[model samples]
Target: MQLTSTIQKLHERAPRLGKALSLATATGVITGNSIGASIPIWFMGAAKTITGAKIADDTVIKVTNYWINSNNALIDNILPNKDWRINLPDDVHSKGKYLLISNHQSWVDTSIVQYVSEKRLPLTRFFTKFELIYIPVIGQAFYFLDFPMMRRHSKEAVAKNPALQGKDIEEAKRACALLKSKPFTLLNYLEGTRFTKAKHTKQQSPYSHLLKPRAGGLALAINALGEDIDGILDMTIVYPDG
Candidate 1:
């Protein structure tokens, strides 16, 4: 609380320095938390793979929950106050399975999802590119946590090599299957990419605010986990400043 007040006061006094300090503080905290949580996750992930141990699987998720809670704490205590209006169904539970679809606008959208979902929903996982595995702790943590990883093929590449066609879909299905046994909140950005005016212009989007949603990913998720999912959730986020 004192730190938050100090930072806010500093911002009022010198905006640039305060902004820099805020970024530095957030980056350091998140980085340290990720690294610390990832070590146990990696070892437990390996154990789960090797032994098919439920304890290992549970431990990984427990650690991940702690990691998220730490970040949520940072948001509550360290960041500036704002009018954060979050509405979730009363029936939603941490042990329920759900498919969450949302508009893609900026990187902060994912963080917002985390913020709203801390204890109200099951652990949130999203589709990630397979190439992200090469990135350090966070990427590997995604794999450990069973976040679906996709290998998307461009139309041109698929056209040139017909063998590549449908491979990504098959891989995505396999990834989704990994979550069938556990409670989860799977997030899919229906827009497929971040929304931009240039992209909106190029696509000649019909909607005033959103890009034309690509339904294939949602279809794939349903085909893979339809029976287990409790509900399909649609979340709309509005940024007043944007």
Candidate 2:
């Protein structure tokens, strides 16, 4: 009873505590990840200066993976009980290239996925709306890392400009090409958005845990990078206690 009461009190005060923890962790991860990411650039720069040859894709991946692993370690230490899990095949690490098709249930899902994949797998990058690219630090990083940002248009706009209809698809292909040139994991959430009670009731979702999977995004990914992908990483995340 006392424990329950204490937990209730913590819940009541969770917002403030969560905000502080998130800020502190974010500061540490961003700073660490930035420095970590720069190490590879530095190495490549020195290699180019000394050897007069561009760093190989495999070598760049190894260097970046080191930083990503360090970032994941920091994340794991901070959120030990966050209920994040990565479900991939036994040969997944051996086959570093993957297409992770997952169901989105919360805003936290991406962070959880990235946190889990940091070092264990390759860096998980996503296709996002172009507007996100204008968002200061995030945009800069996305641009630097060649993250795909699509400009979504209305039906009328597409109808008027037929050329624009397939632009997003083309952009996705380009992004996949960049990943294929190296070794990386592509993260695709088939559900599109987090599952909410309102959305669930609207869609009449078949599963208690997930909505009906959307195929367009996943299809585009498979079609564009099908040959390069080692296999599908079908991940399912469950948070039993909300």
Q: Total clashes, candidate 2?
A: 0
Instruction: Please give the range of 10 consecutive residues that has the lowest summed lDDT in model 2.
Output: 76-85
lDDT of 2 by residue, 121-181 (tens): 7777788888886774455456445566777888999999888887887887777676666
Q: Which residue runs does candidate 2 get wrong by more than 4 Å?
A: 1-67, 80-87
Give candidate 1 regions above 4 Å deviation: 154-163
Candidate 1 lDDT, 88-189, residue by residue in tens: 889999999999999989999999998899989999999899999999887888888888898989999999999999998899899899999998999999
- For all predictions, the C-alpha RMSD in Å is 1.7, 6.0
Q: Per-candidate TM vs. native?
A: 0.94, 0.73
In candidate 2, which residue pairs get closer than 3 Å at backbone N, Cα or C atoms, i.e. clash? none
Number of backbone collisions per candidate, in order? 0, 0
